[model samples]
Target: MKRKQPLLLVIIAFFVLSNFIYNVPNIEAATKLDIKAKAAIIIDAKTGKVLYEDNADELLGVASMSKMLTEYLVLEAIHEGRISWDQKVTINEFVHKLSSPYLGLSNVGLTQGEAYTVKELYQAMAIHSANAATVALAEVIAGTEGNFVKLMNEKAAELELGDFHFVNSTGLNNSDMLDNHPEGTDINDENKMSARATAKLAYHLLNDFPEVLDTAKISRLKFRDGRTYNNFNWMLPELTFEYEGVDGLKTGSTNFAGYCFTATAVKSNQRFITVIMNTKSQIERFNETAKLLDYAFANFGEDTLFEKGFVPESKKTLPVTKGKDDSVKIATKDPLSLIIKNGEKDKYKAKLVLNKKKLNEDGQLTAPVKEGDVVGYLTYEYDGDDLGFITDKESTVKVDVVATESVEKANWFVLMMRGIGNFFASLWNGITTTVGGWF
Candidate 1:
């Protein structure tokens, strides 16, 4: 009885400890960061992998951040030869009135009947967030701001920027446009895009037209090496709230939009794009952005799970029917590299998925396969909590898998002989099976 009492107490204590240990949440699992903004997101600039998000899908006014779309179109036109940097754009009466300093809008004072080079207006728009400069460039490209609005929406759709509506090129409220608003939009309508869409726009802009950064990073804009203005992005070097590696992005604000910013930074060879919409103040936006950038740079890093030409042991070879060679080796078409959370590098599993449509009934590929023919994909499954990509809800990161070498079709005689040999082998096996069953 005495011994039983001690054992019973021990069991009770163990049960209590076990329950406490399991029921208590993991500290790591509780690491959901709270960002004080209406919408915010952080993504890997290279891979579009979303690192963190808070109400990122909510539609809200992007303010001057809307000019990023305009910037993309302008850069695209230049690249396609439709426009040139040296090409001059003439300012009109509407843009002149809109750009007037007395109207309480951000502008560099464009004069009506005066012409500025595409490069000059782009500098004003990109560096100062000048509303009139943006509109002038729009007019030069599309003949009217309303027509430019259509081109903006069309290009937005082409870029797959989901949940976006552009009513103007400069991102100002139509009422602010002083009744010279686009033809199709209501007088009060404003340019709106979700934080995810905004980040994607920045991604495409930086990726497609990298030269925009060359201008965006310029803290002081010099026109004719004389007139100058401060860049709107305060996070740039030597500016207020300046953060290391922050350069070449846009900032936005309006009475309705509060303060918004799309910022990109590079540190330790890793680049991250962050967006915060509707923060309480201009400074608060950069502060919140700093937290996101800190989290990204501190917690995430680029990792290569597999090198190019890596073949999964389980699916290293694929059978090729009617080919000079009976089989072909398969491998990853490129290195499987992506941004990954720190300390979770080994938690990813690789899988080889073959294309079913290209295979015959026996699961064999037809001959005449070319080298580097994409037959399938090499996908990775992460074992940890995945925030998912901003571009889509695809849970796995994937790369193409292709044939390591080409396989020529077998000659007719060689194929016929092979078919005959298979038939005889099958017949012999069936006959032996029946004779064995009789015994």
Candidate 2:
């Protein structure tokens, strides 16, 4: 009967252990985001958390902001040694036409016969929105805008920008084409960019070409031998509205796109990405963004939602019998984080529950146990509702469950003892083996 005490305790402990593990993560300490915009999303660039958002996946034309992608591709070429900053590019009619509403010029005063460095022309495209420079760089990279666009589409597909479709490197609506013109003749990518994707693209751009920001950060940049163009993104110099961290990206204001802006700000050791579309006025774009930025900086501070190797002990590390290895350590393949509401930091919580019996036996698990293999799953509950499985929320975070180690069975004596021992001994051995791991 004394032997029965521990065995009874094991059963009681099993049931009790789950009681604490499965309850909702604490939420009395979290904050909520207060945002009002046609479309908006605020994400923590470090952990890729979608801090706040609206219509993040909705298609929207980004206008000049499309240049963010262009900048990424150009910088990619430069990094790959495809072209140098000083390489001379011959001027053409397309380069000449850049003077029209492109380079902030009705027409840039480029002489019919002249050559410019790849660096100078690109600066005009990036800073001044020079159409000619866009075409020139496209030609240099792939010999034609059409080819470069093919490259653009390929990159889009690779980045999984499902809502993305690139018809021209310039992102202009080609009136010459379009069998069905009733789509309102929207220029550029036609569909508006969601607040989330803008954030994703901005994050990608910064990671890809920080140098672009170096130039975009410039309040006033000059080109074309004399004509100077000020950044249309007027938030740079504590400007008329005090856009302190306001840096470069692209701004669009076609009748259809209606003042699109993708803005990034860094303060308090945390960086934020915001996208606002179809604002009533250019100033509203700046004003709304400033409000968003201020809220993010003041109300939201950085939290380590995920560290490269932070696996809470709650993750499943099941014991195993004889096999190729000793034990199996499983964890969520992807790093997890929270994009909590503006004021709800303390309210954020996580709980891990292991699905023990469901895991296969034969003292074996299914093949393909990656380092981050998930033997079980964890649910992320915000405010006490089951969020189901946390797959890709915005399709940006990538992760897969991998097995940390292969499980080899215990020695013959241990297995024999496991079979003969009533229950407590088996339980004790399982715990020790699971905790101590393979010898």
Candidate 3:
């Protein structure tokens, strides 16, 4: 009795410890980061999951961040075989005038009557944010800057950037284009977009044309005239800030737009895109971006909820009626991953939900089901406030549960044969049991 009492106490203690561990909630405390900008947003580049946002939907002048879209269109045109890098573009009087230093615009000093290749103009536009080079490239692609601006708007619409509008290929304000307004448009015209939409654009641009980063990473390049053009992005190493993982993105500032930056950084296979619009100063844009990046990398990480074609171990097989097999295996069509806060992996739970209405009276699927047929969905959810995730929103990941193999319906003859086999097996088992009992 004394020995049994000690064992009983140990069992009680184990139950108490287990209950405490299970009942204690993991909390993701909300973190507050002060960012000084009119609009700012941070997103996971791969997942497109927004990590932080402030006035992100508020529309504002984007300034030269518009160049991201311009560069994207140029790359698209190149990939489409519309133009090649070595193709020389003539320096027309219009472009020459815009490239002049007297206009107080960033230019690459293109000489009138002289021709430069598509590669030179692209380098100038991307590295120097040269307005003239941008227009030259636009003219080459769409025949006219106005037409290219139309294409830009079309692409913006296609990208679902509802709040974006572009009046010119260059993001120059109308007032700055007083002498250059050959089209006679308003001086107030400038490209406008929300920080959120601009981040989305940048995300697509990087994912679609990763080569843009190669050009954007260049700190300095020489024009055909041997004149040097320097990149304005300060986030690169040996630049103003020297952020470790910072890479190819754009910066913009105008009297109307103030200062704006779309920055991307990668570390540990995780990439983050940060956009800051209308900051007080150029330095502040980089500073605020650094702060945002620090917060995201420190607090957030990703977790895989399910691998492609993965089914929960317990639910490997599901009931199937009127079929040759009594059960069928199932799996998900795609891998399920989510951007979760650090130390919150254990809080996530996944459930397999079947389409019960499709089941027969016995709660088993009918036959003639093909492989990859959708049976239901596997939903992943988190129940705690530790991650600060929106509880009212839908599940984090929902993958389609599919049949692993086709199950043919059982024929009448097959069913009769199976019944006969079961009857004979039962009779043999009964005879053996009776003989053993007699012995």
Candidate 4:
């Protein structure tokens, strides 16, 4: 009997262990990326939600990526009528000298005396990353590369690029100083920006002037001189590395700033902007971008939680005090959405939170509630207490809850009638209860 008891105990322990193991939830781990770069960031283009990041705030030379801001300013100028696309710009000796192949800088081979339209120069800067063309366009807008750089810095500040500073319109290293430089030129000045800040700049660039994509997405284009210049961004189809949905953005490299790329890809109405900086080689930059894009598109997507003027079916009515209507319907003032990761939808939850201060002593809203009057907010949560599932990464969007119907104040006669009806109903309920107890 004693030996049998020990065996029985062992069996009981085994079953307990097995039950625990079987019931444990298998939660997938967060996605891990093996990115080989000094700094990197991936963000949703529209919402600016950061999906992935590593050392994204480390300041480093951005090289030709600075030209993106240059391109933005040029586009802004064009839109504001400061410059026209067809307006011809004369190339100065300084531009020609820097563009010379001997200078070891990227150029579209503009001659000192040659004239090109603003459109041609903009294309060269946007697609080919022609430093000379960038400088020429800057000179035309702000009078000098230094002045133009000032505008770039100002705009960067306006955009809240905390870690960005532009030393020159062209992202050329200050070490590459030319003889008899311009008066305001800083021989050692170079553009410095963090990957995070650069992503913000790229976001605004794409949003403000989408026309830049018309030039940026072009894999190749002919200069006014008929010389073909292929885009430096390898993510395009015309280049060796062909990433689907990758259209336009920018690429940068220098002795100081290793291969860097700010890439954007859109698939099924979802767009992502990824920035990789200080990578070892051009191939690695594009490859790392592909990894980031793949991870974003596969795992993360935008989900609209509520549409504009959407009211929750549950608890849609709030009690009204001394009003024509006993209750008022409420709903969200604007659409609410979230960039949820895969497998998180089931964990999503939303609750309508009313403004208690807006209520009277009776715990009901006061009369004269107008439609569209903000009464509270719709708060959303995901897996609030459940760690057994993968949930949103600690992000929430609150939508304004507003009254959907107007409730005018109750008139004196209406208030008297409601009081009399409430008194009679209470008296009848008490009398019925007393009589039933006697029975």
Candidate 5:
């Protein structure tokens, strides 16, 4: 009994340490980050997960953060072979007009007919947030700013960059453009993308054009002469967090938007992309985003929370009926994981727990299906209060359930008739053959 008591005590101690005494490391939370931004958001870049936000859905002028969308379309154009970075873009009168020093735009310094590579324009637009270069690239890619705006809206809709009904690539307050008039007046209540979409946009740009960082990382770049400019963001190595992993993102500010930042940081094998819109000052944006990142690193981590496959224990397996195989197994298309506070794994337990009504027996999609389709959702939940709805409860990721290999072209009406016909024919043939054999 004495020996047993000692063993029980050890077991209890192990559970206590794993579950309680040794909790998830507490990283410094947002410290003295008191600033009144109209909007803000922090996100997990890799998973396209939103971790934090303050009025993230409120639409407001995003300011230079608009550059991220411009960069996204430019890269897409490059990827689709519509344009190349090496291709030279022409500098026109219109392009020259947007390059006002008062506007705080960097210049490409192009003489009429003097050509610069699309690559250089990309750098200018991305690194310097140069208005002239942005217009120049837009002209080259879509042949006009109007056309580029069309493409931008189309792409924005496609990406679901929330609540925007305006023209103009620069999110600068355009008070007079009648095309989509009445821009949301309340900066705190301004039109904006959700933190998830904004973060995803930032995530795409940086991950796609890692080279953009080489230029963005440089705090100053000279243009047109010895004209040197400094980065608008104050969250670099100089601050308290001194986030070494931080690099290459845009910052925004306007009386309405206040001070906003879409920041990307990399630590170990993980990356976090954050957005803070309508902040009080550049320092506030920096420090707030840093705290968000610190919290993410301390709690959540990137690991396969749930993988796509047979549910194993669930009654997930179903009959294929007319398909090639017996039945399809329902599971995740890709694994869902989190960068969550430690022992918060239970929060995920309810997440990976899926609903059957949302799935089909095919384990993929039910019907009216196309290959490479989206079938269900990966729901996540976070019960932690300090982290809020960021890392703990996540945006529902889509689940692509697969259909069986058998392609049944007929709809339900035809399938029913066909099934009946086949059954009757098989029965008739069996009866006739059996009778003949007996005779």
Candidate 6:
């Protein structure tokens, strides 16, 4: 009896230990990553796939992050030849007063009656988050900060950045502007944007003006007067919150914004953008961003689900009405590459959409089919919680599908025979229906 009792106790202990070990990882996997912020989002930089989001669409103050749009406009003007980097800009008395160190705002002191080149002010604005430098650049571009705000709003609309409003170029709380707030805006107005919209702005900024990183990545910049300023983004190398592959982007903080950051990083050739808004503190923003980024890099990798020229089994051939061949083989014009979560590959499926303009009334190609002709689009579907693209609510990421080989027009006699056969088939169907009705 004693030996049997010991055997029974051993069995029970073994079962309990095995179950505890098995459930530990399952519990951690279920929780995944959690970001502590008012709003947050992480997305693939190239494909705009939303990996994770929490209250990303809730509008919140953006603080100096508004300068990203201003930065965009400045780059656009330079590219369009409307402005030059070497062009000298005189600091107005208003900006000079606003830039005084006495105010304790982030700035590079600007002296009145001294002209600074556009590039100098840009470096100050980009590297130091200098408010006065931002306003100076705005004035150079639009003759006044108020007019520049108009351009900012217009560009925001054009970019389709929903849930955004630009009240000023500097993104300063109108109250902080010391009674010099831009015209047509209330004194309390501050730039506001949802995390999603901010991500979109960063997307466009990187795609349209990739060189912004050249400046954004600079950790320290020296003004002509010899005052050096360090970048506020501590994620940069040698900074306090350094993270591998961390690069150019923007950071904002205010009484209302509560430490917002738009951060981008690349690892193993895969790039991701993360936005954290309204974190508890400056360090908390970077800590939360690190958590989000680690989640992305550790759990996701670049995958080629379908290679170029690959054809879907269900949609391998498109019918041709008058071509020598009755059908044409179609394949993807480009590879379908995505940064997807590991082990979730089976949940995705390709969706092919044929071009309606290329099809005839019978839903077949009309005549000669040329090689490499665009016949449709190849998109994908994931049976998971898809937060959708950051740029738009309903837009789907897709690639072009095209014909793999040419199908020349059929001979005149062959076309005539096919037409005759189709006509007879239609007539026979009609005659059978009429006879049935009589019965």
- The candidate scoring highest on TM-score is 6
Q: Write the per-residue lDDT of candidate 1 for residues 1-439, one digit (tens) a residue.
A: 9879999999999999999999998777655767889999999988789888889899999999999999999999999999999998888899889988898888888788888899999999999999999988998899888899999999999889998999999888889988889888899989999999999999999989889899889898876526678887888988888899998699999988889999999988899999999999988998999988888988989999989989987888899999999899999989888898888879988888889999999999999999999999887878987888766735347789999999999899999999999999999999999999999
Global lDDT of each candidate: 0.89, 0.63, 0.84, 0.85, 0.62, 0.90
lDDT tens per residue, model 5, 38-148: 566666666565555566665666776877888888878888999997997667765655565554554445566667888877777766677678767877878776687
Query: Distance from true position, residue 93, model 4, in Å?
Result: 0.8
Instruction: Give candidate 5 regions above 4 Å deviation.
Output: 1-35, 102-110, 175-197, 206-215, 236-242, 304-311, 315-336, 350-439
Q: What is the C-alpha lDDT profile of model 6 across 1-439, one tens digit per residue?
A: 8879989999999999999888777644553567889998999988787888889899999998889999999999999999999999988899999999998789998999899999999988988999999999999999888999999999999999998988899878999887999999999989999999999999889989999999999988888767878899999998999999989699999998899999999988888999999998989999999998998898888888888888987789999978888898899999987778898889889888899999987889976888989998888889987677776633346779999999999899998998999999999999999999999
Q: Over the full model, what C-alpha lDDT does candidate 3 score relative to the true structure?
A: 0.84
List candidate 4 stretches off by more than 4 Å.
1-30, 177-186, 307-316, 333-335, 351-366, 371-379, 382-400, 412-439
Question: Which ten-residue region of model 3 has the weakest summed lDDT?
Answer: 385-394
lDDT per residue for candidate 4 within 94-165, as digits (tens), equals 788888878778888889888899998899999999988888998999997777877888999887778987
Model 1 spans > 4 angstroms off: 1-26, 223-227, 322-326, 366-374, 393-417, 432-439
lDDT per residue (tens digit) for residues 1-439 in model 2: 9989999999999989888788757554333334445677666666566655656677776666777777788899999999989999888765555544533431245544588888887777776666567767888888877677778778866665556656666555544223311133333334345555667777778766777778776666677668777676777774465566667566666566677777776665567777888777888788877776776776656543544344546545555544445457765555665444455545645555554553565534543344555555444446633222111453333333446665544567876766677487878988999989865
lDDT of 3 by residue, 369-410 (tens): 789889888877677643222122345457888999999999
User: Residue 329 error for model 6, in Å?
Assistant: 2.1
Evaluated at residue 23, the lDDT of candidate 6 is 73
Alpha-carbon TM-score of each model against the true structure: 0.87, 0.68, 0.79, 0.81, 0.64, 0.92
Question: Which consecutive 10 residues in model 6 have the weakest lDDT in total?
Answer: 25-34
In terms of lDDT, the poorest run of 10 residues in model 1 is: 389-398
Model 5 accuracy (lDDT, Cα)? 0.62
Q: Would you give me the overall lDDT of model 6?
A: 0.90
